[model samples]
Target: MSTPYAPPAGYGDISFVELVPLALRFLGLGLKLVFLALSYPFSSTKFSLKRVLWRQFVRAICPPSSIRQLQFVCPATGVLYQKYMRSLPNKPPVISENIGDGISLHWMGPKTNKKVMYYLHGGGFVLPAVDGHFYMLDWWRNEAKKRHGIDFSIAVLEYSTYLIDCTSSCQLSKARMIGLINFAPWPTQLVQVAAGLAHLLKEGYDPANITVVGDSVGGHEVIFLLAHLIHGHPAADVLNLEKPLAGAAALSPWLCFGTETTSWKQHGHSDVMPLGALNKWSGWFIKSRTRTDDSYYFEPALAPAEWWGGLEKVAKNVLMAGGASEGMFDDIVTTEKAMEKGAGKQVKLEIFGQEGANHNEALVEFACGDAPGSTNYRMLEWLKEVYA
Candidate 1:
């Protein structure tokens, strides 16, 4: 049977260890709600409560201590983080590989370096990496071996907190670098990812062998990176991934911020993330004070149909999975339609479990077949077919 929402064995529920952070989340959430309510009289904006609450939880961990000055606080919090990291269950061995320039490569499973899966985790582009991400990475490695007898080595690029092509002088400007945590913007994040991918290609891994996957906002990065590759790059000097990627997968990606999405309104009813928080953080990360009516950061869904048609050379195969119940469900379906119609049938769309961290638990469903016709089972089948 599909595992319950409670974390797996030894990966216990948010325990007493999390009480302090939990308390802060509640406190911060209260203040945020109060401000949101007050501002609504003048602003009249709607957002997701759960997403706003989760943002508070992430902020407690990463903090506004700023990226450069993180040394001051890492000594105290890093130890606790390490301890917590150790408690997560069934993660594959992740080795830290320094790819330079604040872009680090986390290798999951063995060091074969072939059959690599490039991944990025999502926390609205503000939070630090979570062990759940590593758990999913490990699951990908193990599941591939179990189902298809293939040993897949996953390399995830964890981009830096600050970005390069910051458009606005708002929250993430160079001047804001003095003491604030500089959450990155635009092509900068894409460039850092490309840099890491370039390092892999340079080290002799075939571009056709690398499969890129991203979750939530990380999914947006994956799409953005692929789209930019097709369009010949927004800034060629910054990021022009000349070689084609084997495939790409976006797990319930965060798309369609500038435009209106039905899911943004129905988030509380389905998806785990609230649209309010998505709207808030996306604006900050994009550094756009005024919401544009179209094409938020060249989001593929908003772009012309030609963008999807160009994916023929950018990716060999593309897999998109989104929960039918997820807030982003409509957008995923929308993008999938575009890709299927415009990009050819090289793209496949699979509807999976309910939203939230439960997507990670689908690994169990794949292993046990507790959910008949589970999405990951099909996912594994696709991998075997393509990678064979």
Candidate 2:
């Protein structure tokens, strides 16, 4: 008999700590609405109340920083660790081996020439590691084995971050360095991931059998990988291969930086994210990476409309997913719009709309059946169609 599914504990219950962030987000949105209302008459564009309300709603539900904390802290390092980290009662048929440099390969089913999935974890470009995502990872692996009936290998890339003092430089005050390294101007981590994928491709894995998936900031990494693969190295000579991937998937991706999206503007209240908080985090990120200016890697959305032109022909299989009820809906929408406008028919978008589902909830739904409508199941089905 199949084991009864239990929702991860700590998160199942609401707490003051969680409420604090939510309250702060609401407060910020309230402030922004007030300011926009007062400045609308004198403003150039008529203040979009719908946009403002929508953004505010998203802020109240899917605060970016809060989502980050849940992934890195609550699941990886908090009291709920047991619920999320415990090995499945029934171990998956696949074998998982950890390759060094924060990468791991989980091979499922009998060894055969089949598609490989490169899964990247997202934590606002900061927290969480492979272990934190084991539950969802294992679930996907098993599902792939059962549905595809072909061996599947997952290359989990461990990318460097500026927030964790893991690097030799333990200096936490280096906000500029942290920002540059953590935000990563060139998607250096994605290049490394591509390197792993290339290794598999060279080792008998077909180029057409590779699918790259990432959540949150990792979702942004998918675009970075495609952009780099198509356009060549923008910042460094990392990977020289020009092979096209089978497909790419991003969940609740943070595509733009400092744009007036739902998250950036705090729903409609400029005060939600607080210029002070933004400056503080931005400064910290920049200092951690030891970068003086962050415009190069930090702002991909601001790139010219023709930036994705090179990828038009090469990137034929692209899957972008986000929750309509989340603050990142605008990010996903805008990104899809950009791709549609730039790449024309090259990109394929699959947006999963879960009413009342937040950002973290969207991810949880991808790996676990937390959100309504069995979101993870739907996503896996989509992967099956793409890879099959």
Clashes of each: 4, 28
Model 2 Cα lDDT, one tens digit per residue, 144-259 = 66887544666555443333332345364542222111233234555455655655656676656778888777787776776666665544344444555677777767666464
- As a TM-score, model 2 comes out at 0.63
Over 1-388, each residue of candidate 1 has an lDDT whose tens digit, in order, gives: 1111111122112345455554566577678767765665575323244333444443443433223223232221122223444565854343556565545665665666578888776666654445445545555667788877977787666555443233445643453221112245555566676777777777778777888887777777778777766664544334444666778877767676653566545553334444455555666666732233325344666665555776767787777776655566677777766767777765544434444422222332322223423455556766775576
Global lDDT of each candidate: 0.56, 0.53
Q: What's the true lDDT of residue 199 in model 2?
A: 57
Candidate 2: stretches off by over 4 Å: 1-86, 89-113, 130-132, 144-151, 160-191, 238-243, 262-283, 289-297, 312-314, 366-375
Clash list (residue pairs), candidate 1: 47-276, 48-274, 48-276, 66-181
